[model samples]
Target chain A: EPEVTQTPSHQVTQMGQEVILRCVPISNHLYFYWYRQILGQKVEFLVSFYNNEISEKSEIFDDQFSVERPDGSNFTLKIRSTKLEDSAMYFCASRLQGSEGYTFGSGTRLTVV
Target chain B: QQPVQSPQAVILREGEDAVINCSSSKALYSVHWYRQKHGEAPVFLMILLKGGEQKGHDKISASFNEKKQQSSLYLTASQLSYSGTYFCGTGPSGGSYIPTFGRGTSLIVHP
Candidate 1:
């Protein structure tokens, strides 16, 4: 089965530094999303992208965060100045139009010191 | 808003049956079920839409009740592979379709 792919399975960065996580969503998927799971917590939705623009975003997705579909296949999330609270496993997901399920990538574990 | 899931955790043996329930305070447009092993991404199980629809995938099935704003996931004849945390994500009608998930129901199936 085709799957969403994410790079930098694990990343450690200093607080106040910049980090960019890359993802390649499944081809032909119209909806792409980014979610994060804090240690021992429920998964939280960060943002959703469609048609090259942000469809919706949660409060957690603030000015510090941004997402881009730099290409037809590559989607990226950039955090401009990370904080300790930003440490978590970030997942990238994609869904076909009218599909019930969203295929998720393994995840990118971001750890800010 | 996030849904609430009942039975924080359950222990079962092979072939046993189990039911996990998820409820929301707000009306929902769709309910999605997923299973996640430790330190891994959640795997999609099934989705139940509004209008009181029920969907089944193999021995795992789920039912959604829009009136009650609740959904139930049923596992029949559970297998060892079923040992994981189950999450129910609920999306509100007329929203951006960004579904929020419950804490999760942990299932530990032993031999």
Candidate 2:
């Protein structure tokens, strides 16, 4: 079975530095999404992308956050300036349709110090 | 809004049954079920759309009640492998593309 894969399984960055988390969603999936989970917290939706554009985003996805599907298979999330709170397990997910359940990547653990 | 999951944690013995509930404050278009083992990605189990649909996988089953904005996952005759954190992701009505997941219910099944 094809699965969503993410690069840099774990990352450590300085508090004010920029960070990019990369993901390659399921080959045939269309809708792509980014979610984050703070240690011991529920997974929170960050943004949803379709047609190479952002469909929806949460409050947490503020000015610092951006997503790009630079290529056919690569989906990337960029944080312009990281904050301590940005440290979390960032997950990339994709689904064929709204009715289908999403397949999530193993996740990229971002650590800011 | 985030869905509320009941019974933060549960412990069950092999061959036992368990039910986890998820309730949302807003109207929902669909509810998705997923299971995540420690340190691993979440695996999709099933999705229940509006109009009161029920979907199941093997011995795991789930039901979505749009009228009440709630969903429930049923694990019957559970095995030790069923131990994990189960999440209910809710897609609100009005074409909201992002699904908000509940806090998750942690289940520990023992042999």
| Number of the top DockQ candidate | 2
Model 1 quality (TM-score): 0.97
Q: Candidate 1 at A58: error in angstroms?
A: 0.3
DockQ value of candidate 1 = 0.85
Docking class of 2: high
Give TM-score, chain B, model 1.
0.95
Q: Per-residue lDDT tens digits of candidate 2, residues B1-111? A: 889998899999999999999999888888888899988888899888765888787899998888898999999999999999999988773467567889999999999
Those runs of model 1 whose alpha carbons end farther than 4 Å from true positions after fitting are none
lDDT of 2 at A96: 91
Candidate 2 DockQ vs. native: 0.88
lDDT of 1 at B23: 95
What lDDT does the true structure give each of the candidates? 0.92, 0.91
Q: Worst ten-residue run, lDDT, model 1 chain A? A: A95-104
Q: If you superpose only chain B onto the true chain B, what TM-score does each candidate give? A: 0.95, 0.95
| Residues A9-107 of candidate 2: C-alpha lDDT, one tens digit per residue | 999999999999999998889999999999878888899998889999988999999999998999999999999999999999999986788999999
Q: Candidate 1's residue-wise lDDT over B1-111, tens digit each?
A: 889999999999999999999999988888999999999999999888765899897799999988999999999999999999999999873465778899999999999
